[model samples]
Target: MGGVVIAKFLCMAKARKEYEAIVTCTMGCAFFGAPFKGSEMAKVALLYSSVFGNDAYESLLSFMRTETNDTLDEVVSDFMEIREKLVPKIELFCAYEEVPTDVAYAERMVNSPKMSSLTQHKFFRAGAKKLMEVGFSGLPGTHFVTKESAVLPGTHTIGLTVGHADLIRFESITSEKFVPVKMALTSMVQTARINARKRTSGQNLLSHKFVNQVRRSLEGVDMRQKFRAKVEQRQTTSWLTSEPQYQQWMAIGDSAKPLRSPHMWLKGGPGLGKTNASLAAIHTIGQTQLQEQQTESAGRNETFLAYFLCERSSGYDTAEDVLKNLITQLIDQEESLAQHARWFVPNPGYRGAASDDSLRSDLDTPASGAKATATVDNLWQCLQDMIEDPIVSSIHVIISNFHLLDSGESTTALLVKLREDAFSTVATPRVNHRARWLITSRDDQHIRSHLTAKCIAVIDLENDREYGGKVKIARQKHAKDTVTKLRQTKKYSSDLASYIRNSIESQSEDEKWIDSLCLLLGAMPNNSSSLTIRKWLREMSRYSINRLVDHARDTILSQNEDLTLEIDELLQTLTIAYEPPTLADLAVLTEIEDIQQLTELVRKCSPVLQIGEVSEDRNKVIFGHPEFRDHLITLYHGDSEQRKRYHGSMAWRCFKYIEKSYDRGQNGDAKGMRSLALTERIIDDSNVLVMANEDEEPDDAGPQVKRPLSVARTQSSTSIDILAKDFQMLRVSFSTTTGTSGAEMKAYGANGSEIFRQ
Candidate 1:
């Protein structure tokens, strides 16, 4: 018999949002009973309409109007294709059929105490009303109906039933109502096709949104730009490729064969170019990937590379930032992994695994605070899962400056786990794709303890004669390049250039010596004679880089007494800057109105700080080498309190600069202003934290009165210029020795009042 009555019931149930009942009754009526062929098709059409939403029905007419010329066979083929696409989208509809259908007892079960609570549910009330309308109205023999309920053979008829006339007669729409039958089938297939595509498109957009959200939260810096700069500068690590340790570390086997040693730890002293070596390995891997793509090999193993270069100056110092950066790189290589990371983007504080329940929990949990960042443990878990994905054939992870990571235990564990998995005695399918780690760092005790295992290989750059020779050669080349540039300056004559070149060659092995001599010779006044140049060479050759830096510090302090305060302020500002400030940035921060005077003062302090073009051709006054900076910091801020005091002084200068320069009434940058306000708050809070931890009581001098910009530069003992005009809204984060977590800064004003306290 036709399912006209069933279709009516489904429509009613759908109106009440009774999707479960519509799905259940349609499947039961169409599949169980000896229903007419046209009736079954009609019921299926109604099922698709109710489940797929109004758009599903509307799309059918559009499809039919455009496809009138298609053959019956072509139409059927198209319908089957659409059905295949819709299968995943309607899995829940199919699931309803598997429920045991004991229709005889369904009506009675509805009256049970267990169902009492559900009686108040919308679907229950809707069914109750239908039952009341069809009281004892069903066909007497085949179907049953009462004031409380109605029962059909194939479905648990809540309160709706077929009439006696509907049971006896079969309405064959295929024969008598051909148009209706054709329209029903066409609409059902068209609806499936349109809805499937719509759902897929919607899901794709949502997935991309999730990926973007996670990526933004990561705050990952692109190490590729830094890598490119190293390569462009001719800082080659090609020599590393020749080392036996390097050869073995970079070696890989087929999927069936395990990695002999997947972990490589490159330890060295500072300035040994370990970071460049890691970048070389990454560059080589990239070249190999490019070659593979060009070859179009059918069976080539896909290799994925994820790397993070940790530099404290760029805010990549914490273990959390490391893992987050690594995860970001991984997502870049395998975009689908972002779907996994999406679960944690809403609440990075949620450390649970990615599951339906955990995802719900993560979404439900609110972010802990305004600055709530991704947690290290959660990122670690996400990274581990990504590496283990079956689609990834091989993965190479390179982390440079591992020692710079504040909390590296999690990273250490991940490396260990990868190594163990690569060579595990117990074989597993997931181990088919293993991760290899190449870590470069100083010979820190913590790193040594973790990576000095029998299975891991450590390459000591300090003792490697070949590596040392390469470094010496590189240094000599750098010295020659410097001399060539100095000769071009015309400030040095032929004898002076030859003498400097000979001195550089003789001390190529002493990097600091070459570095110090280069700075001294470069900074020599144009009027200096050969005797003065020889005197400077004697002084440079007599002392080590450390002693030279100490001597330079003294020389800076021993300048004209009138310029002593100005020179000291300049030194302190340079020491506290995150990165070397440009001349313009320095001028604004130092409040040195005359660029000519600032340039002369910078040249006078050249032995301690040298002006050089660092990335992007921007000339900045930087230390000759990291060693010189270290020496200055040790000399001026050896004690933790002194360092905080300097930082506080710098924070105050940044606040003052923003206060004097920012004009709120004008159409100034709203975003920049907000950033400045936040920076001020962070500086103020940092000052408070610094004051709270002071070991001694403050003097009863109360608060120092505000000073004019001109007087403040010379009179304020704690004054240090940290605010560059361009970096007035720079991010400032500070942590204390008392184990307090880092907070954005706040500043202490002249009257001892806190500015931007919020």
Candidate 2:
């Protein structure tokens, strides 16, 4: 019908001789209409010529014609018989028809003399004008327009609207496959709908600032980066995926009715790779869903993957944090869910208001009275509403370290309620949404007792023989890989390398222990003689993980008294830290003024404190293995005295850092330190201060002065002074009814006399 299409057909036919078959088929197609004159045939022939240029299309039409007799009437009957089969052949034409945008086409129709002659009624004219402005693609819903009521069609267009039909067909095609034609049709259809919605809703609904505001209010960490780091560093094997239990679990999750067994509890001991396995499962689900989103089944169901990693010292150890985190993740994927959190906005003008107090209120603790309970209830209700939203197809939640949840029973009960909402009841044949939960935790009796849903599938990694075998194999492979690399780097003899490999493989199937052992082995001095390596390799298998850690610790501490003290300082600081500290923060906390000095200390303690690059220039320090932290804690034997000293040292260091930054006019650093100090509870109470004279003895010391200190962040503050007087040493203590009391500072004058007491 268009000059461009005719030229394209002529160009294609000239390029390929086999296109003559398409021309024949086009001629046959044109025979269905009016008399087949030469001029008339050219019009229909060119229209159908580009339907399909391949032999398959021609052969199908030929087969249908052969089924009928050679008579003209028989041919026409055959054409009618296969017309249904050939209807989809017009997809390309429909795709071409999308070249003119919906708005453009609407304007053309609105101004057409033919449409005016066909329908001059007021309603028809008005509807056409609306279409010109909004376009057929911009129609909000099926209710946007309708045909004549119950009698004659005097006031409106007849037949199903071409725009609605085109929209339905375009949506189906876009969801079903990735055809090049979809780019055009989807822009005219799907994108138009999205644009219409965007126009109807305020632009701020999708603003980055709005998203960040909601994210901060939830007080949840985005664990995607953390998981990605783990997944990148760890080498995964298919043994876990190939296991029967895992396969069945995956199958059920992939099923249409995943709610039948919505919860999967993966219970294992500390050293096992439960976290690793959970990461792998999340990765697999994410990849599968991403691939599915480009297939026919994509439109049938949508899947959202949300996960949380709970760590005890990371401050993400509460059930409330988990609910908030999952809700945040869900709402991030679906913005409509944010409406449920409207109550959280303390001020009605919060949309554009830049108020820090309001934002901080959202993260307040239970000590704040009824607001805490209200916040938790609101979060729980928001989570429930999200799960019940009909727009959501399925939500897969993968939570690791479930046992670490502070309020396990309450969290478990909330989870059970959420499961109920996702699942169908006898009264309701089915639920519109599904939620699949994959939880990993230690085999704690308390947690097991609370997670007793009949629908829950429990997989115990510790006791399963097959799982144990897989872990052993995976560890053995890991050992071989590590030894192969170490052999080359350490330049060991082939025999010695083989011996080291054998010793490593001979260790237990604990992934953490193997990793720790490998780290220690890698950290061994490359210049060490072959005999030394051989001796260490010989003793490795017989040594338990604790003994190995102890050996490493003693070796590092035996270097020198000052270095030993520095190492102790580093370890103590790392242990008490509320979150993993960057290298600069660690250096400040350890009181190591020199960067090189702190770097050396980190290297010496590499076997215990793992150093990872957070960025190109910044490094984060964390325990290389949980066993090492356990060993250190056991060695301390709950040394409350040393713990208090460590806490005091950290708090004082944070204060000093902030003070120095302020003195240097480094406002950014000062502000950062202030926030960090408050978050870590280094300067917790608002009205608290410490004062003492480290230079004088208690017998002749000056009067002790007490002053109320408020460490709450103030936007306009330029300088801060929490101490009443300049003192060589300060002591602060914290007491709580919640079993969190601790002595903070210990000070001794020149005569070694205790100068202050809380």
Candidate 3:
């Protein structure tokens, strides 16, 4: 009991007239979660039992009654039985013992005594010692803490340890217990506050550096949030909800016998709910975590961690972006990580404590102008630390549409790194069994081979249930039932579902497609998100789909010279420009008029060509979908002559643009002529041009005759040179004094070489 607490009670008593009686107990009794005249330990022991009023107790009982022979469940039920036996522990609670932090009475506070700093300090030490005496059986070095153990409210654990020595010394005292304990208590607060502030400053120092690095990489990234929001924000009752894969994934949450695998690969084809599944997984995990957090007064240990969804059209398609953003979210979610951030601050010889200015120095650039930011290794180290943290049972990192990385080097390297994290056998992995990688991707060869090389676990939704027997019949029946349920809702119009299924050209993939189509059609029976439905509906409808596919077909196969300036330029432009090119960029690069011509060209290549603001400051024309882009790459890859012709077409566009510049002075004539001269010089060096020197003959009717020369330099992998040669006319219009045997023959070159014949 301390005078400081008595004053607080008196202050409160003045504000309220409900001070019927004063109750008091131990000064540091909040350690056992004790209340004034109440034992927290006894209360908790009773509540931890399956029969107790706690939500977790009830949850445990419900889980036990699920009737499972599963080893994990059996283990959990065994623990539940132990809890059941412990319900009798309630008998240990006393009606009037131990002090709650809330009601400190005058009797609890130190009374009259000779005031001295040293004597006051002694009482404060005993008070805190009493708190620790109740903590962990008070016997020290004998405790079983779960991996998911979290901080309870009003616990001064970290700061108390940092300033433990100072806590036992006091700057002031009153005449109580040889000296007043309240003065000592006041001294404890001042000292602890100083230590806590110092520790927080150091923690925030390291924390801000990590955050800045992550945010710098994600300057304007919003696609990840947008994609996650769409899926999570949608109605929960979808085809995905009822699926077995979803059920199996939920197994990740079973902590007693938690799934040991850190990585879960959700593989499927396009339109197979891979993205939707990622969203659903995030939502489900996050919701569960939030509920647990709400129910129990614990700090940042909630498990559904971070997710990154790759959308190629958005700037988020890059591997660097995904990794950085995921790390950022991890840091944001776990503020405790900041306390330990000094462990991950990349500065060499770091003492693990720094001031705000010292933090800037920690991440400062070197004299060589190289970055001092956290690298992959640093990020990896942080994740490893997070995994080792007991509060985090699992650090889940979900990535969707990994295939849309467009086979980038960043993508491949990132995948390999992720695979390493997934299956690292090191005693201390970046993320261990508790660290999960929930990924969704199409089963492309690159993805298959990369994952196979490392031997990771893959959950292919299409084959979630095998065929031929009870499984096959069940799946079929399930699919039919799903369709029936969906059909009852007006949202899943018969025309829409029929159109989607009937349009699929292959029958072998029908069962998988049927399930996917219906799942996508009616996410919920009636309350499927209007926004989601509208997006897919536009793409799923027969008319819009037909037009889109029609455009793709015409562009891929069109050889109509009339429509394409008799050149194969536009088609190649569509296939090869993997990076989006703005209309102005395309106009300049392709040498077409910027305004109407480029717009018309993109329109003609509709569906295949999508226009959007891909990057800041520039609107771009990019391929609408990853699958579509990959398909084009495959088509062009298979055909040799077609590829060469397109290459020639690309060069042709450049040549024609230079020619336009020369003829019309589009850019100043001097610059145009200089460009032309540069092209001719290259052509001359290549020595693959045709000479069109005139013969010793002159036209009988025309004043001057011109011959067009088409010449190409040898093949090149990067750049192709096309030259159209027309000799400059020398002023020799031979007005034939013409009766003399059909005019005399003459010849000339641009540099004037005249020839005569007898």
Off by over 4 Å in 2: 1-209, 248-259, 292-300, 346-378, 405-433, 529-531, 614-618, 626-645, 663-705, 710-758
Q: Could you estimate the TM-score for every candidate?
A: 0.55, 0.60, 0.45
True lDDT of residue 221, candidate 1: 52
Cα RMSD for predicted model 1: 18.0
Local distance difference test scores for all models? 0.53, 0.53, 0.44
lDDT (tens digit, per residue) of candidate 1 on 1-758: 22323434444554465563343222112212222112212332343344334455634323222124243224334422332343222211100111222333445666778888987787656755454334212312322212211122222212112332232233565554234334444544543443343344344644666666678667545666666655664455656787766765565433234544676788887656676678778887777766654642311355678887775433355566677888888777656667657655643333333322111223223333213335555667788787766445577888888876644444466455545644552354434536777889888876676667766667888887867778777667667877887789846778888888878777554544565657656666778888988888866776777787777777777875678878877876676565567777677557775888888888777767667665742487776666677566556666644555555555455554656654533466543332222221123433332221111223357642322111011110111212222233232222222111111233333332334320
Instruction: State candidate 1's TM-score.
Output: 0.55
User: Which candidate leads in TM-score?
Assistant: 2
For residues 277-369, could you state the per-residue lDDT of candidate 3 as single tens digits? 677777777777777657422222346468777754323555655755675566566545544334334333243332321112221332112
Residue 253 of model 1 has an lDDT of: 31
**Among all windows of ten consecutive residues in candidate 3, which has the lowest summed lDDT?**
735-744
| Superposition TM-score, candidate 3 onto the true structure | 0.45
Q: Which candidate would rank higher by TM-score, 1 or 3?
A: 1
Clash pairs detected, candidate 2: none
